[model samples]
Every structure is written in structure tokens, then in C-alpha cells.
Target: MHDELPVQESGPTASGSSPASAPGSTPAPRNPGRADQLDRRGGLDRLGWSVLRPAPVVCLTLVAAVIATGFAVRSSTAEMGILIWIDAHHTPALDGVAWALSWAFESPRAIAVVVLLAAGVAWRCRHLIDGLCAGIALALTWGTSYLVKLLVGRHRPAWTLLRHHVGGPEQDPSFPSGHATFTTALVVVVVMCTRRGWRVWIGAVGCVLAAGVAASRLYLGVHYPSDVAAGIVYGAAAGYLMVRATTLVSHARPDRRAGQDEDELRSGPGEIS
Candidate 1:
């Protein structure tokens, strides 16, 4: 018999040795659960950076300003003079306008409505981050307004001067007009959250609403000008800072798959053989 050549395995045989992947081949798909975990971790990291970067300084500054204004209003007669001047100039016809404008913010309902609307808009846009930011900003505005009102402990303008006012069984202290605070904060957040193409319209509408709310408080003679002014300042600051934080976090770098795809493309066959 011819000398039989020793049988040699040409490829992976029943022994089960597999071929090594090519050097530049695409990696195996990542585990779905593990990938989601990584994404969540990265999101948290971005959110932390966004919160830590500028929020503390800005918030502290705003808090100091609000505190100073609160003290000044409590200890001085200037604000009273301003309120008296505004009250003296009220017109009967304006009562309807003031009442209508002020009605929305008469309670916490208008703020809640705005928060819901903002969330709805974000959901429509498929941007969950925007919704979260809007909700957080509005909540912060409400909580801060409540705390500051408690801390300031200033009473509302005297009802005797409120001739053109609408109906009320009002009981809240009014160093900072809650209506003004909520409306201003709502406007700021709405404008900031709008897309560039829609920003002008949204901003214009927001300004109209905020101005109407502020003027309504003065016309109703329920809030001193100083109270509304402080509310505007505080609310605007809170909305702006929160929007900035959310924007920073939302702009985190895209998924790693994009980079991987680019690398694969660069390393793909130069010319199909």
C-alpha cells in the first residue's frame, strides 16, 4: 500500500476549534442590559456635571438678592409709596382685563397647567430631557416662592386700597407676588424650552403673559410693585439656571456606536477584491 499521508484537518473539524476574528472586524454586539446600564451611568455623570458647574454660584447670588430685597421691603416705606401711586391710577375699565389676566394665577393651578403643557410639548418633540427640565424648573420656582414668602412674612397690600380688585378670600402673605413669580418663571422656562424656529413666537407670547400677570397684580392692588419686581427677579433667575443645567446635561456626547461605526468604515475593505 502507498504510504498514507497522515490525515490533517483543513478547517475547524469535530475538535471544535473556531477561527479567530479578523483584526479589523466588527466587535460582537454588546449585551442589551449592560448597554442600558452604561447609558444610564453616563447620563447621571452628565447631569452631575451640569448641576455642579454653575448652579451653586448662580443660585446663591439669586438667594442673596432676594433676601436683601425682602429685608428692604419689610423695613422701608418706598414700596408702599409705589403701591399707593399705582393704586391711585387705576381705571374702572381695566378691572375686567386685570381680573381676567390675574385669574389664571389666582392659585397654584396655573403653574401646574404650565408645567403640564411644557411636559406635553417636550413629549411631542420626543425630548424627555426637556420635559424633565421644565418640570424641575417649575417645581423649584413654586417651592422657592413658598419658602421666601414664609421667610419674608410680609402682608398683602391693604384691601382698603384695592377698589378695582376681583373676588377673593386671599390669605397668603405677599412679599413676593405668587402670581408674578409663577408667571415669570413659566414664561422663562417656556421660552427657553422652545425650538429656535418657534422661539420668537413663544417668547413674544410669554412676554405678553408675564407682563399681563405683573400688571394685573398692580392693577388689582393686591401686590406692591416691589413684590412683583422681586418675584420677577427670583423666578427669572430660577428658570434660567434650571434651563441652563438641563441644556448642559442634554447635550452630552452621542452614543459610542457612532464612533464604532466610523472606525469600521475607515477600516472597511479599501477596494472590494
Candidate 2:
């Protein structure tokens, strides 16, 4: 009689359950689907991407510094008096220039136009993310400043505190200067939005315009120096956030370890050699 080879009976293992793990061998990955999802998202959790990608730590640090500075400015009597004195000493030519800069650079209509134009340029260059990032920065910065205004409820400088007023009265809370924030945002957006010619020129022009807008708020005696400072810092932070957030979302560099784990799971355990 020929020797018969033993037949292995799979029993319950026939239903496709994995073999039970022996003590402390690295357990097989329980969720290949989740691993795949993570791989698709560059193998990072949301918080991991938010903190690790695009120098988020630096951006966060800048934001913290600005917040601290805002608190310090709010409490300094000397700082308050300095701006007040500057307001009292404004000249007609300077006032006109300031008002013009504010209206030309940061008016609602002007902002809309700039964003739309930036979008057009970015689309033409096949880099739509830049445009989207710019829009987010502008909207986020403006919204945050507006919310702070409402929370602080700091009124505009008393009309009597200055030489005189020319424009229509602002009838809203004014702790942070909306013009300052938006103008700075505009500058950053212009610098970042497209790889077109004249970007440097546009950025330079934007910086001058932003500076002028900040000065105009002081010259018009409508916003405190602290308000302008806070607006500038907030705008910078918003731009930094926009750039990093966009990068974090768009990046898809595969993680070597995650890819390996996923591959191993998909291939299943190797047969004993």
C-alpha cells in the first residue's frame, strides 16, 4: 500500500478568519480600509498634518506673539496717548492721501475686484489653489477681525479727539481696523497668488498701499494704534494659515511605512518558507 499524505482540515478557518495570534507577535492590522484611507491622505491624521506640514509651528508661534502684543497694547496709556497726539497733528495733504489709499486699496468693491482678478490670473496659470488660498486668507482675516471688533466693542475715537472729521460717521464697533487687516491680506495675496510677471511690483505696491491705509486710519482718527497693529498681525497670521492649510490639504507624498503596512495587509501573511 502507498503511504497516504495527511489531509489538513481547515474547519472554522474555512470561513476566512485569520489564524489566532500567538503571544505578542505584532497583531495583524485590524483595518486595512482605514489604512487605505490614510494612505490616500498621505498617511497622516488631520492633526498630524495640521501641526507637522508647512512649518505650522512657526505660524502658530507668530499668532501667539501677535495675541500677546495685542493684550499689551490694549493696556498701555502711553501708547494710547501717542496715537491721539498724532491724530491731532494731521495735515490736509496727508489726510487726503490717507483717505485715498484706504478707499483705493481696501474698500469692499476694491477687495472684490482684486480677489476676482487674482482668481483669473491663477486659473490662467493652472494654479487654482493659489487663488483659493488668497480668498480664504482675505475672508478669514476680515471675519476674525470683525468678530474681535464685536467682542471688544471699542468705539471709534471720539470725533472731538481729532482736529475734524470729513467722511461719513462709522456706526459700528472699531477695536480692530478692518482696512488695515484687509489691506495687509490683499498684499499677501497679491504676492502669493500667481507666477505672473509684475508680482514683485504688485507686492511692492500693495505694501505701500497697506502702510498708507494703516496711517489713514490713524490720520482719520477712527482707529487706535493698537487696532492697526492687531489688524496687521492678524492679516499676517491669516496668510500664513492659508498657505499652510492649503499645502497640508494638497500634499499627498506617500509615507513609506504606511505604504508598507498597507501592502503587507493586502498581500496577506506570507506562507512559511
Candidate 3:
């Protein structure tokens, strides 16, 4: 979201002081107090403020919980159980639909497209920070997914042995589904960048899209439920962190109006006129 600063016209004031002082006149001194305050608020404080919001806190907690659960259950038995159940009920129609959905969101291209669209919207709205955050989030999601896959070293579901096998062979590790991660990250960026009035609609659509991508992974017998779940958690966390980073950087900029607003927020109610 963009915040408009009020425009100030240069002219004589009520006291008749010229708007432009003489070239030899001493320049107004910098506000030492403001400088001190800015110095005190280091990068850590900015980051803390960015992530201290309620929504981010909730999302971060969920991410931690999901990661913990994944660690606790090292085996894919739980994943296999769900996959088997889904396999038992699979139909040709479902397979066709899942295949189409899965094919549509394969890897970096679909992820890049979503990020680009979100960035385009943000740029159109004159919210450069939002656009940057979207791009950062997608980049982080992709990189993190690859790193985690390497660390976890989990194999993709062995669909060839199954009677209802429809999915093609996948070479990547399967602890976290990249498609799910990318789609979820995109959804998070879209939800955060959208205006309040249209946020609900955007969020709803994003949720459905994310869910469809996740489900497609399962229906295609390529990813286990746990993989998709972990991916979602990773993606959401990445998006949240990137958004927070953008906010922190924006606030930390040398903007007079922004500083005044921050000071007002910090001041007691009695201090406000």
C-alpha cells in the first residue's frame, strides 16, 4: 500500500520569513534527537517491528508447528497411508483433471509468472515495496525448496508400483513439493498486496488455487500429503519474511513524514494535539 505525503508550497510564512533564506545564512541544524532515535532503531528493531504484526506471528507459528511435526515423523508411513487411500478412490476423470492442474503449475515458470503478475499489480498501484517483496518471496521460496529437498533427501512416491499410477517420474526429492511451495508463496504475496476491500476476494481465489496445486500433487501420485503440507508451511513463511523485510526497509528509509508518523505512534495519547 502507498502512503501519500502532503505537499508543502514554498512561500513567505505568516511571520513574513522568506521561504528561501539568503545563501550565506546558516542552514537549519539537523534534529539531534531524531538522529539519535534513528540510530537506536537498528536493523533488528526494524525487522522485529515488521514481523511483530498479528498475521505474521500466526503464520510463523504454524510454520514452526508443521516443521516440528515433519521432524517427529521421519518415516513416510503416514504419507503412504494417505496416498494409498487416495489411490483406491481414483478415477480416470480425476486423473485427467489432476494431470491438467499439475502440468499447468510445473516449477519455476508458473511460479515466476505469478510473481510477475503480482509485481505488475503492485507497480501499477505505485507500491514499489510490495512489488519488490513479491519478487523476493518467490526467489526465496524456490531457493529454500531446493535446499530443503537436498537436506531432507526424501524420495518421491513410488507411483509406478501402484495400480492407478498416472503421474510421470520426478527426479527431485519429495519432502516438500516445489509446486505447492511456489503456489502458496504467490498466494501469500497476492493476499498481502491486495487492497482491503478486494483482499477477501483475492485471498479466496489464492487459497483455492493453492489448494488445487497441492491436491494435484497428491492426485498425480507424485507428492505425499506431508510433502505438500511442509511446502505450504515453507512457502507461507518465506512470503511473510519477505514482506516483513520490505516493510522494515521502507520504514527505515530517511523519510520525514514517515518518521513523524512513527514518533506519533510511539508518543502517549496526551502528547497528540
Candidate 4:
């Protein structure tokens, strides 16, 4: 019988020379998959994109335009003329309703509703991209409002009266009411956060509140009609821009990341599985 040669078992590397040539040596190549997994995890577990891509920029631009236009059109005389016209036509009962609405809009109770809603959304949608978008919307509305108010320096109805009188409108210019801005912001924000028919419902509420606040400014004799009009324009611009910004950011977000994020979030909370 021929002498049996000792058989050497071929391990993964065969000659045990290179890790790359080993039987299961493709671990490094699998990094892409792992990275993909992590991306998904991040998307799902953390607030990733903010307000959809180019939205933040677009919103800022739009707000600037509204402010510019509002200031350019400021005229105490025009404001007073509108007040006079409304006062001349509407009944005292209607005015009273407007006044009541004005008070309600600024009340802490109204704000509380918005705060609660935001908080609830945040908690439920922690991993959702939209939560970040919602924050952007709120910030855009509020930031622009204050900036416009300061820049326009429009007087309130309470401080001065509108006069279509002889000397070309009053020097005390009141344009762009804060109350209107607040309500409009709330309405836009509410609409953005909800879906389907909810938008309509939210919009209706917002409109009512905005109108009430605007009317109160007039009733309280603190803001002119023009002020309210400007406020509406400002609010709408902020709302529209915010929505558009959200759209842009959504589009720009990396598609690969979103899926990974979702998967990681669903598979129990840990690092990327």
C-alpha cells in the first residue's frame, strides 16, 4: 500500500494567505448595505430633513416680498376710509360680534390648543420627516410676522384714528394688523399639519379667528382696515411659502435614506439592525 499522505483541511483562506480571498471574506463589501440600513435608521429614528429641501429659502423670500409690499402700501388715510365704510354699512350687532372674536383670538386658551396639537404631533411622529417640516412652518410664520411688524412700524387703531380728512391720510400709519397675522399664521400652520378634509375644517377655524382678531383691532380702534388687509397678505404669503418649502425639501431628500429609516424605526428601537 502506498503511504497515505496526510490530508490538510483547506480552511476559509485555503493557504491562509489573504483575508480578501477567504471563503467569507466579503464583509467589507457589505458595508454599503449596512450604511443603507443606518440611513434608514436615522431617517426613522431622528428628525432628519427640515422643511423639505429649498423650502426654507423660498419661504424667507416670499415673506420679504410681503413685508415690502405691505410697507409700500401703508396709508393711514386709506385705512380710516375702510373703517368708515364698514362702520357706515354694518350694524352695531355685527361690530359687537367682531369685537368679541377679537378678544377670543388673543386669549391664552386659543394658543393652548395650538400648543397641545403641536406637542401631540411631535410625540406621535418623532421619526416622521413631517414633524420637522411642521416646525419650519411655525417658525417661518412667527419670525416673519414679528419682523414685518417691526419694520412696518404700523400704528394700532387704539393709539390713533384713521382719517380720510383733508391733509392726505394721517401721519400715524397703521397697516398690517398683528391680530390678523397671528390668526393667519395659526390657520396656515393648522392646514399644513393635517390631511384631507381636515384642511378645510382647520382653514375655516383659522379664517374665523383671523377675521375676529382683525375686526377686534378695528373695534378696539387700534388698527386700520389696511393693517388688517396687510396682515392677511402677510399670513397667506408665509403659509404658501412654508408649504412650498416643505414640498421642495421632501423632493430633495435622498430616497435611499427614507426607506432605511422607516425599516429601522419599525424593527424596535436600537441602532440600525
Candidate 5:
């Protein structure tokens, strides 16, 4: 008869957990319910994406329209009327929100924070070119607004004209609001960095936030309507150009796209990292 061999236990280990459940021993199971929901939502969003496939053209057309509208109202000071209306309707709650939005994205500091965040995103995707492109694009967008402010040399709206004032004096030229420009430009970069399934949700929310910031400027009695409008137009155009530039770079370097696609596929639905 063969010698009796040792009979190792086939059940839970001494730790009282199954051997297969040991740390790093087996892959964690996916949440089927959540995964299915994401899949369905992602499918629906893709149809919308398909409709907006010519996004660059659409964006340019809109920018032109905004520019025309800005010119139409530049002389009328109708934007001042908007500020007056907002001032008339100010509630304590809205005042708090407006103050928060106005202070949240201050320039230079805001630019630095966003650039670092963009670089971090690229690092997470393991794509160096994307990080560089996003940083440069954001810098250019901010700088463009600054230079325009100097060129336009427009003064801030009169505090006296606004019966109720909220914030301190704004020293910079009031044309092309810095806050509005920064917020708009930042949204574009954020939407670009995220996954396709997440882009629509993020972009829509970001647009709403950008609009809020723009309105806050008018509410605070600092900016003319034309200033914020031009900021939005420039921000969107600069952002669209940045996206196109990044796409061209990615196409030129197929290896980057392949690596990113691989990482994206490995991650579960709606996962950022």
C-alpha cells in the first residue's frame, strides 16, 4: 500500500476566511446591478454623442452667434439692465451662492490649480501629451482673456448705478470677465479628460456651473453683460481648439491612444481611474 499522504484542509484557512478570499488572491466580483445600469445609460448617451459628432463646427457657429449678439448689445448697455434686474431680485440665499461662485475661481490661483489637476489626469491615463496640451490650452485661454481686457480697456460697472453692492472693487478691466472665462475653459478640459460615458453628464453640469458664475458677476454689479458673453465665447472657442489639437496629437501617436483605450477597457463603467 502507498504511504498515507498528508490531507491538506480544503475549507477556510486559520484566518476563518476561505483560501480563495485571501488578500489579492482572487479578483473582486463586479456589481451586476450597477454595471447593467451604467451600460444602459452609457448606450443612451452614445446616441446623443453620435448626434453631436460634428461638435467643432457646431461650436464655431455658436461662438459666431454669441459674438454677433455681444456686438449688438455692446453700446446699449442692456447688460447693465440685467445687472439691475438681478440686484432688484437678490435674496439672501442667492447672495450667498453668488458670493461663493465669484470667490471660488479667482484667476492666476485658479489657473495654477486647474493646470496641476489636468496634469494629474494625464498621469492617471498615462498620457504625457494630453497633460501638456491641456495645461497649455488653459494657460492660453486665461492669457487671451487678460490681453483682451487690457486692449478693450473697459471700466467696471458703476457701484452707484447698482443700488446694492456685494463685493469689493474689481481693479481689472471689466470686459471679458476673468471668472467666466476661467470657468468655461476649465469645463472643456474636464470634459475632455473624462471617459465618453461620463462626458455628457460632466459637460452638462459644468455648463450650468459656468452659467451660474457668469450670472454671479452681473449680480455682483461688477461686469457688463457683454463682458461675460465675450468671455464665454472666447472660452468655448479656445477650448474647442484645444480639443482639436489634442486629437491631432493623439492620432499622430497611435501608441498613446492604444494604451489609453486599453486602460479604459480594463476599468469598469464610469470609473475614472
Candidate 6:
């Protein structure tokens, strides 16, 4: 009789107790979600794609173009034809235009402009990845230009002028201009690295400057017309490769930890890594 009474009373006793008053009972708090992990992972994936995937394409394309241009240069008839074309096409009006535009590729002047432009890009990108990309572009332009100039051993139009005037040294192996290469590289780098809306306009202007420089090389007559042509191709290829490489290199590095902590923290938990 007592057992039956206690069992019947147990239900009512438990039902009357509030959670806080209950023994061995507590509320469960919510947990952080997979959103954080997903954001981080996505960033890493993009980086990997940029670096690992595009590299082979850039390298192979460059190699092919080099071989092809070299073959084209081997044709004497074609080379003579181009020379005739340049010589006949030259006029006072054209010379004036070329001279005016040539100032952009003037070595020390261009270098200063390039440095300032790079600094501005770095400042604006300010993010760790963006800044690194800009830096790499600048380094590639300066370093690769130097390396190519040494290896190619091409002479400038300025050298030929010296022979005629008895003031300048003999023209070096006049092929593949250093000026065009560096300028083209700068153009490609800036265009690729920028996120600005008017970046295309900026890049187009860079192209014009590079073309003007190349034209100047030919007009001065130290370099064969072919030399400037080759330089344009070489510089353009280098720029394309390096800029792509920068993108790849920048993106490839995974942000496992906080990068630019302020940016990361500001991004918040729901934001991308």
C-alpha cells in the first residue's frame, strides 16, 4: 500500500519542480557553426587555384612564342621588308609624335614613375595579399628587365647614333630593347594587380607608352626594326607571365591564422577569411 502511494506522488513532485530548482539539470548554450571553417577553406581554395593551376599555362605559352619569333627573325626577306617599311613610313610629323611620346619610356623618368605608381598601388591594396602582389610585380619588372638586358645583350638605337656622330659607343647586338620590356611589364603588372574600375584605362595608357618607346627605338635607327618588335613581344610575355605568377603566388598562400588581425577581426565570424 505504501509503495503504490509513493509512486503515484513521484510524478506530481517532479512536474512541480522548475528547471533552475531541479537537481543535476542545466540549460545548453548554442555553439559556433561551420561558416567560419567554410569561409577559410574557400579562401585557401582560391589561392591554390591562382598559384598552382595557372603557372604551367603561362610558362608553356612563353616558351612557344620565343621559339616562333626566333624562327620568324631567321627569314632575311621578311626582315628586309620590315626595314623598308619603317624607313619609308618615317616623316617629320611621325617623328614629332614619336619624340613627344618617347618621354614616358626614358629610363630614370620611367623608373621614378613606376616606383611611385607601385607605392600608390601598395597603399591602396593595403591588404596583406594585395600588397605582396604589388611588391612582387615591382620586383619582377626591375629584376627581370636587368636579367634580360644582360642575357639578350641587345644594343640601343642610341648606340648607332654615336657611330654616325663620333660621340657614342658602337651599338651592342641590337635586338630586344630593355626599355620596352620593362615598360610592358609595368603595364601588365599594374593592370593585373588593380581592383579599380578604371584599371583598363590605366592599362591602355601603359600600352600606348610602351608602344611609343618601342617606336622611338626604331626611329633612332640604332636598333633594327626587328629589334623593337622582338622587344615588344619579349616584354609583353614577361609581363604577362610575372603578373599571373604574382596572382598565383599571392593567392596560393593560405591564411591559416589571422592575417592583418584588424581586418580579420573586423570581418567578424560570419565573414570571409
lDDT of 1 by residue, 92-114 (tens): 77877888888877666775676
Ranking by TM-score: 3, 1, 5, 2, 6, 4
Candidate number with greatest TM-score? 3
Across 56-163, the per-residue lDDT of candidate 3 in tens digits comes to 678668766755655555455556777887888898898998988788877656766856765685555454544564576667766777787776777787766566
How many clashing pairs in candidate 6?
1
Full-model lDDT for every candidate:
0.63, 0.59, 0.65, 0.54, 0.66, 0.52
Instruction: Indicate which candidate wins on lDDT.
Output: 5
TM-scores of the candidates in the order shown: 0.66, 0.62, 0.68, 0.55, 0.65, 0.57
Ranking of all candidate structures by their lDDT, best first: 5, 3, 1, 2, 4, 6
Clashing residue pairs, backbone N/CA/C < 3 A, model 2 = none
Model 6 agreement with the true structure over 23-106: per-residue lDDT tens digits: 343432222222323233221112223346665476558645654554455333334444445656677777667665565565
Cα deviation at 124, candidate 6, in Å, is: 1.8
Candidate 4, residues 4-74, lDDT tens digits: the string is 54543322244534234344333322122222332432222211224254654655676677678666765
Clashing pairs in 6: 47-251
* Per-residue lDDT of 262 in model 1: 32
Residue 82, candidate 1: alpha-carbon lDDT? 67
Model 2 Cα shift for residue 69 (angstroms): 3.8
Give candidate 1's whole-model lDDT. Answer: 0.63
Write down the worst ten-residue block by lDDT for model 5. 41-50
As a whole number from 0 to 100, the lDDT of residue 49 in candidate 4 is 29
Better of 1 and 6 by lDDT: 1
- Candidate 4: which stretches are off by over 4 Å? 1-62, 88-92, 107-114, 123-136, 158-174, 242-273
Write one digit per residue (lDDT tens) for candidate 5, span 1-109.
Answer: 8565454444345664534544444433332322233234331112223456677677677656654654454455655777788789988888899999988887657
Give me candidate 2's TM-score against the actual structure.
0.62
